[model samples]
Target: MSPEAPPDPLDFRPRVALASLSGEADADWARAGSEYAGAAFLGGIALDEPTREAARELVDRDRTEFLPADPVGFVDEQLAALADSPVQAGFNVRTTELEPLHEVGAVCRDRGAILEINAHCRQDEMCAAGAGEVLLRDADRLSELVAAAAETGATVSVKVRAEVPGVDLPAVARRIESAGGDAIHVDAMDSEPVVGDVAAAADLFVIANNEVRDERSVREYLEYGADAVSVGRPSDEPAVLDRVRDATEAWFAGEVEP
Candidate 1:
């Protein structure tokens, strides 16, 4: 049998997003696997000044083992690879300081890669900086930024958090659609995924993530409306990436929609 075709986001029925952290090994590790169909921009974002320290702190806290001791060069390597890679790359960039987003988005567009704005990182260091949660509060601006990024013609996606604590998700989704984002990567941490509410994809796409610890949860995400679903931490468990890959393939083939 011919090898399974490489993942084409446009043709992908239900996709798997692998979270890529920053570092030589991290990137290499990501490139090491064929099981994961896509990558998430969930690594270091502090490449410039005034906030570099904060970015480092966040990485250290959230991904100590993977993050490098000297992150500036580390991030540069990742950026360089992202610039040079022929295949599509993944990203979960920080919006707290919108410095390098445009240039980065340009690269993604040129490469047909998907670039995501992360409002989903829950690290306390990131949350306190008026980035993830704070940015969520001003859904209007968030939508505008997402739309602006979409101007590049790259598949611009925004990864959002659980949307709890009185956070109105339908309102957020509507505004994101009104803007220009291609999709909202919802980290459905506390609740199951919801498709109808995301119809406002504004001609974009929706990729569900988080709380997908088992086969049943993955099924729920697709049934609920996610064009695709991301599975991470699962890869960290013992021999779990293989399981995730198998489960995702089986689930998509079944194509159970709600």
Candidate 2:
């Protein structure tokens, strides 16, 4: 575990965020607009040619699209286009090594944005390459990855999958926090309570994900101790962002308190 600085409050903890949704390109960015989100994610962007090729091959089957251009340039371009975005911008990347990850982090640092490592990708190609959920199998290496990127002076977040076959999610979350990760985004699936449990076990800001379709689900995850909740499929609809806003404001106003 390495030391870390406190997270930026405006980074959107305990609020509604747009998760990294897959498309031909990063559509979430354009679609999100200035709608009412605390933050928006820009990938699942692959770092190397193999990972990129894997994602491209999986497109028809898994709908995973890696960044078509160089990752550093992609981040730069995305950040350039979002110079005036209202919400915090986070770039989600999938890579197995620290060098490329560091490069991407450097881009984030130079551009003044957040870099989120994608350990939550479940695609067969990603898993087969030991680049995604496989990181959960080795906490030390995962922590090292987090630590390495954090050293680049970039805000780092580790996104992991909950309910994995042999992965102890709470332990993973703690390790990420110890490694200086600023946030943990959990694809909690149907087990909402795990979000709270992870929050309790680790000091990192927890972002709950999975099946977040409506206001009810958003409120449920927040009540479960997640500092924030992310929506993917539901976020595709502009009206859904309104619902999330209503639900979040209501939560703060005590109308959605459980």
Steric clashes per prediction = 6, 1
Measured by lDDT, the strongest candidate is: 2
Clashing pairs in 2: 14-227
Error of 1 at 182 (Å): 0.7
- lDDT agreement with native, every candidate: 0.60, 0.78
Model 2 / residue 114 / CA error / Å: 1.5
TM-score of candidate 1 versus the correct structure, residues matched by position: 0.77
**In candidate 1, which residue pairs get closer than 3 Å at backbone N, Cα or C atoms, i.e. clash?**
41-91, 41-92, 182-204, 182-205, 183-205, 195-224
After superposing candidate 2 on the true structure, give the runs of residues whose Cα lies further than 4 Å from its correct spot. 1-10, 24-33, 60-64
In TM-score terms, candidate 2 sits at 0.90
Give a tens-digit lDDT track for model 1, residues 1-258: 999854453444226665544332245555554345545344535433433555667556655423345433454455456454332455556655444666666766655566777676566666676556556778876876687677777677777766557677767877877777767777776666444466443455777777665567666776676666666556444355555556677867775443
| TM-score of every candidate | 0.77, 0.90
Model 2 lDDT-worst window of ten? 24-33
Tell me the alpha-carbon RMSD of every candidate.
Answer: 5.3, 4.0
